[model samples]
Target: MRKFLCTCLLFLLLSVPLDAQELDIFGYFEPQFNLIYLDDNYYQLQSNKLRVDLKSNLGENLEFGANFDWIVYHGKREWNYWNFIPERVTSRYSSARMWRYRFTFDDRSFLDNAYLRFSFPSFDLMVGKQQISLGTGYAWNPTDIFNVKDLSDPTYEQPGHNAIRVDWPLRAGFSLLALYSPESDWESSGKLLRLKGRWQHFDFSITGTETEWGVTDYEYPFVNLFTSHKRRLLGGDFAGELLGLGVWGETAYNFVGDFEDFWELLIGGDYTFDSELYLMLEFYHHSLAKSDYRDYGLNDWLRFFYQEQKSLTRDQVYCLIQYPLTDLLKIGGSTLLSLSDGSIALVPTVLYSFHENIEFTLIGNINIGKEGKAYGSSQGHSLLLRSLVYF
Candidate 1:
């Protein structure tokens, strides 16, 4: 059904006799391989992905854009016997549930972005599925509710949200933005309002959001289930240049029904040298995080895995250093350190552009910690190789 719809859309676009400047098409293809080693065992996986993007000018003040992605995967699909356990705790008494993991190589296709925009003299309106990314933090975006960040690949593109969005420019450097995402009921729907502006050399935004967030909550002795809860969020972010470094911070306070209220904060700064070396450091804090490793429980793990919680530990630090070895090659390394438990995750990356239209990346993840910590040695380390070709 999806493939047929995509084919028909392509045929319709091709059948149209519009000016070349009226329509634009672009996309990329990626092939990837992954290997993981843990507890003296190794697992391998492979995937191929294709993305197609389309943009067109329907008429004056009207435009349309869409992105389609199709991906296929193969290899090992399940792993049992690994779990998060704190020090001095046995598996039977562990607070966190044992892992139930799988990597399935199924063919998946989706429309990541499909939206229509109407521009007026005073405001702009957008409708349909579209990317709604917010916040200034790179590794962690505490103020963004529509998406979750993968710690290992923080900058990857995220899925879109179905919403109606409006942007109203208030002044030369200020604007008001609103978004509404309908759900089955009014209470469950997502709504947001933001005021953004620039002052001197800094840009800032204040936002308010209300919605029902789906999450995994514990249901008694060893049982965990998915559920939804209402939450109201008030947040703000600011980015500016301080001295020669780029600095940014994002903070959010959540009021959740039937859950503890807490705060999330992230601060980071980056600098690039004349020699092309770049360096960044960031700090993240979660008020709801467990201060002691032993205080971590099954509920914590469940919520973290389900995207309700940002971190199981109270504090973390991230550092990134990257340099271009040549015009075609770049190397970088990043470290995520858990200040609450002294665990660390090291990620080293290499990128090479073999051709103007083709690029390859090699990434490695190594965890160092005692058993039961966030980045524990038992959590399994992995390496990934991926190639991207652009049309």
Candidate 2:
């Protein structure tokens, strides 16, 4: 999924002069193209996404807001590939699928977020499909359980979840959060609570959640793709500055009914030098992962892909850097390594802002390592070209 938005929205609303009580509308459209090279084969992927967002002040204390997405996607192959599918792809209230023509697979319309809010001096109440994203990590998040992220490109747009949340502010830097999200058929509903605050220069949050998982039957496979299991998650995150450097971390422990407890931890820091160059490094460990790929057979892989486990492999680190070359152009890259098997993936990217309403991006990914290792086994290179327009 993606996490892009909020960049030019404010400008869009203010740039167009409007009456005091007039509703404000803004959105963007992006056409993305990808050429995938893997295992001596090549494939093309393309999709166009459009989102329309609108909001109106119901009164001083109440607001109504909604956004809908219309996406048309077609690729050389079906997106049924495990890695391409999201962990929580379906919801109880989402019934917008239509017109099944299997030339490939795609959906016409998606209801991303539609919510209403009533704000007070201390608290606010929100209901409907919305984003309840939480975390402090950049590349990987061990504590953002509400919406699992694809850290491959953290700046892109992603889908939101259907949930209800209440936020309360206590002191200057202290607040409280509570959220509830239900599964499509009540199979994986859950509740979350977090107490967040800041002391001195450090911002911190402690979170707890109880949820159920919908497990598929190994015996019947696709016939019984749904079952039940309970789990609990306890975690926290902190981000602050350390001696002129940016420091952050996140940790989470899982208690699954059928398996032993497992946990992951990420620690990292970022330092910028010469005013134009920024760099960051992070290291993480997974308690449940093994070194050998054979040990992580089909069932084990499914668990991790579905986020029953937090990571695809264990013992990893990341390095990311960015530099702006000019007023409208920038270059960036990132590298990820699997310390367990010494596999690594490298990504190089170029970004150009043609205008305030248009942009272009080019990126390439290269994987290197021995066979059977995490990034090594998936060794190949691919390029992506994306165009974005705001209207």
Candidate 3:
């Protein structure tokens, strides 16, 4: 199997030029240093990551793209310390690392406008390993959050998916989308099928997912909702600007079994003070269901869910302010307060552009919460710096 895969890759590479195609390469590198301070001690860590994407565009509506990522970590590790330490009495420090790579096929490799579409005027199709974001909020996707890896400990690393999708454009500014996935490891082993539609400023979706919850597997159905509008409702210099707001909400129910359900709601908006400055705020509430598979059986799936248990009801309020220091420099910061547990967190970021294609960014995050709390961990603060060159 490995030999056959290598042969196919070799053929593709060799035939690129012969096929009269355009080859484009793009990627970014991020190397970070972190200093995490707990109540008693401080942990220092360093890590490096590299990602590259190559695209071969064959004219006449055919294209292929591949992506490769490498991540390495060194120094003492914290956060989720239990995963690294088996013994309670042992104070061992460890190094962590992982890597992933994927490839995708699509009609066009970049800048997809309605005008460029020809093959299927009313329909669009995308397949293979790709990234999908399904909602307006930064982190709420009850129906499709393919790239959300960790919830308790949030990271900048986005989640990706391997799936097939079909999109149909309806009349009068309306469209419909359908997605299917044979496998998803992040959602505790699940096969998913979803359908969604958008009209004007409103969006709705429904998904049916079957996964192993415990010794007894079950299927869950979820519904997602999103609405947004950018219209002027007030007077003054902000008259022509957007005065209306946006909102998103979702709720889920379990089918083929009796269990608790989950739901989430978010409302927020962005207002521009001027071209170079803006402010935004959002409020979120999540009600997660509790599982009882462990009480029924001692199965591996049940045990895994128990060990990875999460909270049931939480509230988050956040605010962000951004400013452009110059034509090439920009800075922004955000603060999040957890209402249920009364925890606070902060993230600060800065970006500098050297030219049209070269840019640098520095970002950092810190969580201040009580020990044994949802956000508490051995790793207190983390930082990352990145450089990108686009072509």
- Estimate TM-scores for all models: 0.90, 0.84, 0.66
lDDT of each: 0.83, 0.72, 0.49
lDDT of 1 by residue, 263-335 (tens): 9999999999999999999999999998777777756765675577888889999999999999999999899
lDDT of 2 by residue, 197-235 (tens): 998999999988878755543224333255666778899
* Per-residue lDDT value at 3 in model 2: 16
TM-score of 3: 0.66
Q: 329-361 in candidate 3: lDDT tens per residue?
A: 999877776666565667787889988877887
Name the candidate that leads on lDDT. Answer: 1
Better of 2 and 3 by TM-score: 2
Q: In model 3, which runs have C-alpha deviations exceeding 4 angstroms?
A: 1-17, 77-80, 83-122, 149-159, 184-242, 246-259, 289-313, 375-379, 389-391
The global Cα lDDT (0 to 1) of model 1 is 0.83
Residue pairs of candidate 1 with colliding backbone atoms: 73-105, 77-103, 95-298
RMSD of each: 3.7, 8.0, 11.1
Report the number of backbone clashes for model 2: 4
- Best by the TM-score measure: 1
> For residue 80, what is the lDDT in candidate 2?
31
Model 1 regions more than 4 Å off: 1-21, 79-90, 93-105, 218-223
